[model samples]
Target: MRYLEVTVPKGRRRAVLDVLDDEGIDYVVSDETSGRGFAAVVRFPLPTRAVEPVLDRLNRAGISDDTRVVVIDAETVISQEFDDLLDQHSHGGTKGSRTSRQVLRTKAEELTPAFPIYVTMLLISAVVATAGLLADSPAVVVGSMVIAPLIGPALAANVGIVTGDDGLTSTGFTYQATGLAIVVGASIGLAVLARLAGLEPAGVDIVVVAELQERVSPNVLSLAVALGAGVAGILSLTRGFSEAIVGVMIAAALIPPAAAVGITVAWGMYGAAIGAAVLVIVNVLSINFAALTTLWIAGYRPQGLFEVSPTRKPTYAYATIFGVALLVLAAPLVGVTLVEFQATQLKSAADEEVDAVLAEPEYNHLEVESTEVLLDDDYPLRSVDRVVVTVSSSDPGPMPALTDHLHEGITTHADGPVVVEVRFVVAEDREGDASEQIVHTSSGDRDS
Candidate 1:
């Protein structure tokens, strides 16, 4: 519910009052004595969802650019008629619950902080994210996201573009670009410093770190995170949900990968850095694309553009640009997906071979433990580097022939050269038994 106050211009008071009366909205009219607009002031109460459409009607009824309209929250209304009006709009779905463009625009602007503060917050978050990635601490990484001021600029850009506020749109874009650049730059500086101070040892293999490894794999799944974040962020902004939680989600898609790019580059792993860089780029584009589409579908459009063509033209243009850019960036992600799929198939086949070999009578005492598939750190697409299988047995023997047999069986499923290694773990029972336990079987009987 909202309490609204609108100052009507001269000669437009009757149309305004008639529109209000037609909708059964209750309002109070007072004569304008300040002599600024030379008319009457109308105060009204409305359901939150009814504000936009009712305001549009008032506009068509001759509200001018100089007209003053103030919308504020209304806690309670005692009128049964107002309750019926609220019930009607409540059943209208998204359009009913959608925040007015006036309010939405204000929220976007408020979310965007001052320039200096924005940059400072961005740098701090980036440093924390970089440290968290290196330390492989998910909690710290999430903490970094909480303070990130990224959601504001990210959604504001789309909001401004959809509403045809050119200045706002431009400022939103500038803030986004500036914020990301600062994050990347700060991460690089910090990572390099960490390396120099021996916090990260020389010649370290950064990919071995679990958190950093995830950022280097830019697959189709990565796209979903970014798209979902963008949609949720905007929906939260317009639907009166907690934007702070959604803001963390937006940061999750961007901040970690952006930091990974710097970390990998600082470690001189240029190929791996490309993967992280592509992920960051793809996420940014996908988030923007999803945001623009979601806003349009929610029936938001340019306000106060004076002409319909001028309003719709820019909105369509911005959407098209974001959509096209996202598609272009998705190419590499698709490639990565295909590579990962093939690698998975190869690993599954290797597992089956190990199971079959262990089923043989001669190898009945050996129990399979784990199988690992390693891949190269390449951009867009990576290939299997090796497959290692670990088996456990208590028998005191070399088992070198098992390695040969396993390698021969696994390589048949590979399209190219893939190294296969086998490891044996000696087992012992709690009863101090180090000998193998074997079960002997006959045609119709089995014995242990």
Candidate 2:
């Protein structure tokens, strides 16, 4: 049972009303023009499950994309006469479902566990994240995820906004932000301490192996997983489906990567840290958006009505904040797409150059060590300085065709001068011999 006072364009009022009417919603129309839009005061009894569809319909009907929907508290409504109106339309299958979505939202907000739980979860996550990184154990990482309390606040934040309850919104934000900061801060602190103590984990163990595999730009698929997790989180909270959130827990596994970011930073790898931090932001924003959408669709509203018009200053402030947050989250997603595109192009170019250079019939097993676009520290006109290439092999025989092929292929592909560095490792028993294999070596001057 949510009371909504919405303002839509005068042109779309009839269409909007007809949609509402078709859904069996009882609403009153008030004709009041404010600033740039017409205002309509609509009172309705709607189930939480039905809110999303209504919002989508309104959006399709060209209701101001910026249309303001404020929830009115029906608890203080002087009209006891509306009791029968509410009873007839109540949802019967779900016992608690019939309660006002606003009421449910308020209840959820007040359901914040004690501070002790926060502390406990923080320490547990830190320890688990650390052990996972050291031992390279996915099972330990999952165990840490299972004990994490992050799900509560993530779901709460979305519910708070959709329901238009300031208390819920603020509480949700506070809890999630606090938990995130604590976990990240602690992980960073611990990793840095470990490095100072010369306790850095080394080599490609299970944990380190996982870390190396995804050392690149995140894709749209990551965003989709986050969004799905958010939706699952909301369902778990509302429908008392606690087990459902476990899947959400795994889908948007936030802790391990965040801890990995900290570890990378401690190891002085700023690039990896940047990528990991972007991943964190991506997951957080996607989850929040998905959760907020779910709550709005559930028909949650703030209890209580304002006889006085809602303040313009605060309303616009919220819109501005929302717009900025959306942009901040969206900017990284766009950047990820661009980065992925660049990586694809760069890889293709590298492969073409390598293939053209190694045109010999017998020479094979060419591996590229690294590809970087050299940049001048000062000048804007600094183009790609040169292309660097490294090659390794067990076969020792010198081949003139392979060398000549590389020279011609690189010159054709690169915009600037291309420099190639080739190395041949002379090993007779390259078979099962794991003794010593020189994978890569960089030369300052290719001619050397």
Pick by TM-score: which candidate is best? 1
Q: Model 2 clash tally?
A: 8
How well does candidate 1 score on lDDT at residue 294?
93
C-alpha lDDT of residue 51 in model 2: 52
RMSD of each: 6.0, 11.9
TM-score of each: 0.90, 0.61
lDDT, candidate 1, at 131: 96
Q: How far is 373's C-alpha from truth in model 2 (Å)?
A: 12
**lDDT tens digits, residues 1-448, model 2?**
4466678676787888988877666567877656576646555645444554565566667664477776543443334434543444445643243334534564465555566887687677866776676556778776777777777677666555555556666877787767766766777788778777777557312123554324223545666677778777776666656633544373335776677667766666666566667777767766776676665565444432341134323434544564467567656556556544554565467667776555545655654445443322111112344444555565555444555555555555555454543444444564754222322212222243
lDDT of each: 0.83, 0.58
